[model samples]
Target: MSVWDDLIGQEPLAHTLREAVAAARDRLSGGSGRGMTSAWLVTGPPGSGRSNAARAFAAALQCRDGGCGQCHDCHTALLGTHPNVTLVATDRLSIGVDSVRELVRSAALMPANGRWQVVVVEDADRLTEDSADALLKSLEEPSPRTVWMLCAPTAEDVLVTVRSRCRLLVLRTPSPPAITRMLVDRDGVPEVVAAFAARASQGHIGRARRLAHDEATRNRRREILRIPTSLIELGACMVAAANLHEVAQEEGQGVAATLDAKEVGDLEAIYGASARDGRARGYPGALSTLKKDQSKRRTRVVRDTIDGALIDLLSFYRDVLALQTGARTALVNDEVRADIDSLARRGSADSTLRRMEAVLKCREAIAANAAPLLALESMMLDLRV
Candidate 1:
């Protein structure tokens, strides 16, 4: 097995990275790493496996056999447990200056394995302006044995200066068939369920897995898909919008439940504070900071859920448009073709396009930190036939 085994729909990209790994090995043996560099910027659409690509490359670089999956070097590097590997994946909304400076310090350290010190950042696009600026100097003049691998949703998402210092590689969305095959073969998901999840996810690998594995996730998606059919009166629009916000918040909370408690527990342990104790000295301010961070995290999570809901709606309307135009494309929501047909018969192609535009606008507004309920209400009204 190879580290690239799970990277579905990216055979060409895998080949490129393998070549880079060979060049990197040559560099370690006192030759020039012509095809590889100290810094790399990896960009891709959401769920295109950008982080996975980074981790796989990191493993390949550290592995003596160039990412043979059975090797200890490969296993540890992929798990972020290798002495020479550092993985930066933030739970917070943004990566600040302090975190970047800390990484810079780590990047300067010597490799314990005598190969390379690899740092893989899974969300480089979330870096704050100050953090990007702080990261600039290290990227501009990287250490000889230090490799910085950054992942972002797009090239434009990173600072031009930092981006310019790194070799750029872009990943494409995994085709639905590719995602379905991975789920069926690797995860043992049922073929039918895997197919539906893959088509519904529209190339997002993580969500497809969730949809395949979790019944509650499927139920919630079903509820959201039924929203358009419920938009009858003004009151119905208001209700539908409110229900969508609640649904997103509920989904977000499901994720936050475990993570939030663990964070609090870790903070209490660090400060030697307990619920039974009156309080530890300086704990209140630290607790306040933790609360703020948790709040920001919750907001971002809910907003992301809302954005996902909007995208699902976009797919529904797009199907309606496809039907109205007599296009023979397969529907993303083929299971609900009855409802789709009803919607398409009632609406013109122009109206379907307009509704899709509304969904796009709502997604943009929520991402820009607008009030979720308000934006959703406006969008629901626009979606009404």
Candidate 2:
């Protein structure tokens, strides 16, 4: 087995990265090679496995046998337990300068057990301007034994200067067949369920797996799909918007509940806060700051969930438009073929297109920090069929 094995339908990319790994190994042995580089920028569409590719590369760099997936080095690096590998993935909206500075400090250190100190930033596009500036110096003069791998949606999403300093690797979305095979063979999903998920998720591997395994996730998607049919009048639209918002809030709470408790517990432990001893001095202020951060995180999580639902809703409309136009393409929401056909029949192609535009506008509004309920209400009104 190899680290590249899980990277389905990306053979060309895998081959290129493998060559770079071999070249880096040769350079370590005092033999010059052309493919090796200290910094790499990996870009791809959402769920195209950019971070997976970065992690695989880091594992290959640390592995003596060049990413023999069974080895301890490969395991540790992939699992994020390697002493020489640092994987920085954020749940926050942006990567701050403080975080980048700490990573920069770590990057300056030499490897303890591996050939290179690998630093993988999973969301390079989320770097704030100050954080980007802080990252520039490290990219410009990286330690000889350090390798930086940054992942983002596209090259343009990253700062021009930072992108210019790294080798670029673009990964394509895996095909449905490839995703289906992975779901069945790797995740042990039933073939029929895997096939449906692979089709429905539209090349998003993580979402495909979730759709296959999680009944609640699939149910949420079904509810989103039903929105087009539900928006029959103003009252219905308002109710739909409220329902969508509520679903997103519930999912956001589900996602954050455990993490929030763990974070509170950790903070309490650090400050030695206990009911037996009462609150420690200065504990209130620190707890307040922590709560503020958690509030921001929860807001972001809710917004992200809403954004995903919007995407799914958009896909349904796109399917409607496709049907109206006589397009032969497979529908992303094939599970609701009858409903999509009914929707397409009820609305003209032009109206379907207009509804799609409303969805896009709502996404923009939410992204601009407009009130999500208001934006969703407006979108739902526009979507009234």
Candidate 3:
């Protein structure tokens, strides 16, 4: 295992990154009259490793051997300890104007390592309008040795002005076999567990890895996949909706709570002593910021959890669709084939497809800022009928 292998199911992306690195290196080595551009946009869906591609490219650019994978530059970049590389990863909802201003000021300086100064913004979508505008100016007139890397779900997530000035690299979801092979060969997971996780994650490499490694995650998924067969009555549908919302909340809270505490603790340490005498003028504002961040994180968690559950729910209907049509390809819920057979007998293929459509609508509603509880409840009611 080479370090790049951690980027599972992303061969095309890796190839593109490699090509970019080779070109950048060739330009940097004084072989071309054209100078290397100082900005790049790496865009992809969730869990598509846009940041990973950017980081790998960064490592390759700084590497003496052009990402030889064994050099100090490559190792440090991969481990996120490279001296000239600055990464702004927010646990909060947005990258505020203050932070953006500071990073912009930093971009003007020469590199401490006498190499390229690299700035990677992981959640470019979270940049506030003011921050985005600030970043736009920096990108428009970059310093000689500076490189700006922004990662987001799509190019449209960043301002068109910012995106138009940079090179763009788009990433795609990997195949299930590619993901499974990675889990088994690289992570040392068993083939059976790897296969299950691969199918369950629907091509998300990180989620699949977690599913393979964590029993609790596996159990949660099992609970979700079991909901379809259990929704046999009106009351049962209501109960299932409530259950799904609660579980998603619980899981999201579990992921966010510890980080939230850490952030609050750090904030207190920065502004505590002065506030004790009622002289900390900005204490209230700081507290508000903390609360807002927490709220946003909670919302993000709920959205992610619900999205995963929706996929799980969709798989059950998909299996039914496959069975009804007599297509013998592998089912997502292969372990529950018997239940699928039973459901197929009760529902027509058209009904199954309609349920899938309802699930997709629920996803759109949640994405468009509908309340999670209401959305889930409505989806459940529709599914029950």
Q: Number of the top candidate by TM-score?
A: 1
Candidate 3 global CA lDDT score: 0.83
Looking at candidate 1, the ten consecutive residues that score lowest on lDDT are: 271-280
lDDT of 3 by residue, 205-322 (tens): 8888889999988888888878778877888888988988998889778877778888767877888787545577887788777888788888888888899889889988998899
Candidate 2 — which pairs collide? none
Alpha carbon lDDT of each predicted model? 0.89, 0.90, 0.83
Off by over 4 Å in 3: 33-35, 272-281
TM-score for each of the candidates? 0.96, 0.96, 0.90
User: Candidate 2 at residue 62, lDDT?
Assistant: 92
Clashing residue pairs found in predicted model 3: none
Reference-based TM-score, model 2: 0.96
Show the lowest summed lDDT stretch of 10 residues, model 2: 271-280
Q: What is the lDDT of residue 269 in candidate 1?
A: 83
Identify the superior model by TM-score, candidate 2 or candidate 3: 2
Local accuracy of candidate 2 as per-residue lDDT tens digits, 183-234: 9999999999999999888888889988999999899889889989988889
Using lDDT as the measure, name the better of candidate 2 and candidate 3.
Answer: 2
Candidate 3, residue 211: lDDT? 95
Total colliding residue pairs, candidate 1 = 0
